[model samples]
Target chain A: MKLAEAVAALSLEVEDPQILDREVEGGYCSDLLSDVMAKAAGGSIWVTNQVHANVVAVASLIDAAAVIIAGGMQPEEETVKKAQDVGIPLLSTSLSAFDVVGRLYELGLRGTLRDG
Target chain B: MPDVKDVGALMSVTYDVAARDFVRAGEAASKLKRLLQQLGLDPAVIRRAAIAAYEAEMNIVIHSYGGQIKVDITPESIEMICEDSGPGIPDIEKALQEGYSTATEEIREMGFGAGMGLPNIQRSADQFRIESTVGEGTCLQVTILHEAGE
Candidate 1:
């Protein structure tokens, strides 16, 4: 699904709108940056509670479609700037990580490597 | 004793990593990734190099007092050396085991200290070496070769 569509489906707050048009191939949920770096597939939407500039770096390195900061977390200002600079959408939602993952799964978003 | 002729012109840059500074932990790795991209290295090679650098950088930030990461990029390979003055690991073998972490609750909440740092870095590099002294510090050297035949 398109990132913009997924954002609307989940009621996520758009932190950066420039990236909403990118296509999302899958979803990955992890708080550990290293886990995402090693395992998350490119073009996947990364769902996590991590709110830091490093999250932006991980998203860029893995070529993630976007980042959804679950639990209504607010990232540092620098993180928002980094996301904008990299042109990756940074998003947030009031739902917990588990809930966000569940909703995305219901919306046909599977894990990057899982077979639906 | 390998032939030095295999090595090409080298470019090096160093970055200082401050301990417990979660805010700036991955800056070195991010910059290194950009440098590798600008050099037109293969995407897979750049990803591996960047992941290794980032994991090492996080280790220094979580476990050390402070340290520096030095990166040397060449046509043949990318090499990273991270050295930090901090509480060195007492048992390297145990520390290398996945899921064994000494990170505090604060660090855990920051999404790290799951004991995957060193292991992940090792997996990302072609050659990895780690040295530590109980009271002194720890040093890691990682090398990632560019795409084979490139």
Candidate 2:
């Protein structure tokens, strides 16, 4: 799925459109940056509630397709700016992490996500 | 000439462990990923290498006094070596248990060093080998097979 399509489907508000063209090949939802860094496949969408800047580092290191901050959470300016600079799309949604994962599953976009 | 097909490409990197520096820890793995990309490795193989490398790197920072990680990349497989000289595990058997963790609260705040680290490393690698001495250090070698189509 294209980044724009993922944003639209998840009802997420993207602060930048330039980074929205990247494709979403998979999805990984986790609050722990280590887990995400170690497990998130490249081009996968990362859904997390943590607003820490380290999240951006993890996304970059793993080459995540984009970042989806759930539960109406907003990241710091540095976080948003870094994402912009790195061409990593940053998104926010009012849905909980579980909710976003469920929706992504419904969209038939699941790929290698750990089962609960 | 090293047979590129049968002999894995040798790559080694040594990081100076600043003992309490968790902030800069995963940097080596990121660089390794970039190198792997430049080599035009398969995405699936790269992902496995990245996971094993990152996990091993994190363990060095969180558990070891200081150490280094070396990676051997091959068209057919990838091998990772992580060696650390910290407070060596007295009980290797128990330490390998899934829920066994010696990580402190500070490490937990950084979201790592979980008792699951070893298990996670094992799970991520297709083959895993670990060696440790009670008062010495620990050495871990992990291998992941690459599917030709991937």
Candidate number achieving the greatest TM-score relative to the actual structure: 1
TM-score of each: 0.89, 0.76
lDDT of 2 by residue, B78-139 (tens): 78788888887888788888767788877676556556667767777788999987667889
Provide the RMSD of all predictions against the true structure, rounded to 1 decimal: 4.6, 4.8
Expressed as tens digits, the lDDT of each residue in A1-116 for candidate 2 is: 88788788878988787778888888988776657765667789998887755577678778888889999888878778767765778899999989998988888788555321
In Å, residue B75's CA in model 1 sits off its true spot by: 2.4
Residue A49 lDDT (model 2): 87
The docking quality of candidate 1, as DockQ, is 0.52
Error of 1 at B31 (Å): 0.4
lDDT of 2 at A18: 72
Report the poorest 10 consecutive residues by lDDT, candidate 2 chain B: B1-10
lDDT of 1 by residue, A1-116 (tens): 99988889888999767668899999999998778888887899999999988888889878899999999788889889889988889999889999999999999999994210
Residue pairs clashing, model 1 = none
DockQ for every prediction shown: 0.52, 0.29
Off by over 4 Å in 1: A113-116, B1-8, B148-150
